[model samples]
Target: MTSGLLKKNLVCRIILICTFLYLIPPQTIAAELHLALADSTCAPMKEAGLAFTRETGIDLQYSCKSSGLLARGIQAGIIQADFFLSANANWMNSVVDNGLIDRQQVRPLLSNDLIIVTRADSAIKIQKLADLTLPEVTSIIIGEPSRAPFGRYAKQALQKSGLWDELKPKIISKKKISLAVADLAKAEEGTAAILYRTGLADFMRLQFTIPASASEPIEYYAAPLKTMANHKEKAMFLAFIAGDHFNKIFSAVGFSVIHSINRAPEKSVKASH
Candidate 1:
């Protein structure tokens, strides 16, 4: 967005906040929770919003994208947001590497199992992880590995599962989780895609697995980007996303909240397949 346009959005947000406070009693205006989600297709995030509005008086306004695209936007100074929750840690790290996130403010918010998704009408019966490489699978859609953390996690899982080398050439890479889902939805020709469990939850026909032995459980993180102008609201929203309230929502939507980062040795993680 142009500088003038961005400034207008900020002013509009501020006005909205002020208007909200004025309508609600002073005792009711506890605080504001400004959140920027990776995207709305993420069921955990969508479900959590319903509860967030109930438990906390704080209002949350969020945005979404494939983790890769979000990183590029933040890195390029194009899109400005506060409290960025990503599908993978790599994107969060990239923002941090560029000094966009303060070390103290960043947190590993959640984790999700990766899955191969197909449209509701697919006839090919996929029972195992290796089935993805079959010639019958016309296409494989996924988020851009470099920009989307989930995409990065998906790539890691593929490598760990021994499918990366074979399927790399056939993967239809995208820049947003929702777009990947859209591609899956449009797969009347029976295309396949890899995405977070939450990304595919709305589709009843989609299948997933949590292998006892497989790739490392993809750890995702959230951080306040430097461009986030609202500091207090961002922190409150961050706390809410990591709180027990949000955790329950995440659990219901097939997500695992990592809570906080553990600096100890990385154990043998059976990546949630």
Candidate 2:
């Protein structure tokens, strides 16, 4: 064959190869699964993700934020995740109602306790919810009720205790629980914060455990996104999440594992959007 004809044939082959590569679906080439988790679950879920990767050789990418914000992101189609681990059922229900997640696949995974904490070195002595109203208690920090489940739980506890009216004036709201914890750590002597009992640092002293009766039960739910329903890696990750190893990871961080058989019927929340 002529050299010129050979060169033309090679160019045509290269173009066809490039076109075929461009037409391949993204999922066919991507081996990583994405998880959207609440910030409070960061430690355990991260550990779990790493463990899953080690066991199955499937990579994972995760985003952590308040459950409300994550849910909103999913509803707005701004976030794409194979799975979502929510801090509360309300936000999970919102996504389910919006068709972002499959309702039948929603699994109750963990539970947490709400507690009042102050810096270990603080002089303020708070024995109960009522002490929050004392003159010496200068400021109270909590997550933003609109974007964080911990914040909503904190608000409910205060309202049920009849302390909301008095404490509202001193309340300082943060977009996430981690920020609230950070603010409390740097706050003055009288500052206190309501936070999840899980993942509390040694510098924070727990003053009170809010009674379960004071607010709705704090439950964490894991739901697979509808778009990833058929993903093989997602199935592996879900199995890992339900296994004893994952349970121990969360329990070590003070989270109570909720077994499938023990899951109670979760209350539904009206979809906000």
Clashes (N, CA, C under 3 Å) per candidate: 11, 0
Error of 2 at 209 (Å): 0.8
Model 2 clash pairs? none
Clash count in backbone of candidate 1: 11
Per-residue C-alpha lDDT of model 2 across residues 6-68, encoded as one tens digit per residue = 999999999999999999986567488878999999878888878887788778888889999
Give me the runs in candidate 2 sitting further than 4 Å from their true place: 1-30, 261-273
* Per-residue lDDT of model 1, residues 1-273, tens digit only: 699999999999999998987798654556554455676335566677777767666666666776666777777877767667766555666777788887566666666677777776777667777888778887778778776656776777778888889987778888777778777776756587777777764553665563624655476666677777666665556667657887787777777777564332122221221
List the global CA lDDT of all models. Answer: 0.68, 0.85
Which consecutive 10 residues in model 2 have the weakest lDDT in total?
A: 264-273
lDDT of 1 at 215: 55
lDDT of 2 at 68: 90
> Which regions of candidate 1 deviate over 4 angstroms?
1-33, 40-43, 50-57, 202-204, 207-216, 226-235, 261-273
Q: What is the model-wide C-alpha lDDT for candidate 2?
A: 0.85
